[model samples]
Target: MHGRCISCRFFANDPALIEATFPGLNVLSSAYGSVRSDAGICSRHEFFLSSWQRCRDFESGDNEGKDALLPVEKKLIGYSIGFGAVLLGILVWISYTFFPTGH
Candidate 1:
């Protein structure tokens, strides 16, 4: 598991009870269910995993840490920003090259 169930919003200290009572509520089919050692279940997404694997549904943690974009996400954002800046620079250069600068 990527994150610890101890901190998840849907995390129950004991999943066997909740899981047994509520079927299909928190299925392990999604988000790679947690290991057996982790008794708690993510009630929201019904996921379980080692707190060290990779938590995609873990919520209720520090906003800064929980909200930080993944490496691939960050790369995409960086690429977009860089592309925008370059595009703006190109437009400015074109304006200077083709259009007369008042100054």
Candidate 2:
């Protein structure tokens, strides 16, 4: 099992570097279902190992995954910004129309 997992040799604490090395690669959990066992490799692990063809040093703890921003949070922020911009534009237009300009 160790031999099988040891085929790949790339591991790093930085996720951006890892991604730059392996493009179009999904995380262990996303590619593989759930990691239930402690011994065997899960889908995500398998995918990572297979795709990158490298094994990380378990002792070093350098293979920390990246912390991704949640999709919901991004969507909410976008909506809020868009809504605020529209509201501000409307308010400005209304004020300009209602208020008389001094000649």
- The sequence of per-residue lDDT tens digits that candidate 1 reaches over residues 51-86 is 443466667643224556789999999999999999
Q: Candidate 2 regions off by >4 Å?
A: 1-66
lDDT of each: 0.61, 0.45
Predictions: Cα RMSD each: 13.3, 11.6
Tens digits of lDDT, candidate 2, 43-68? 33434333233343433333334357
Candidate 2: TM-score? 0.33
lDDT of 1: 0.61
lDDT of prediction 2: 0.45
Deviation from native of the Cα of residue 77 in model 2, angstroms: 0.6
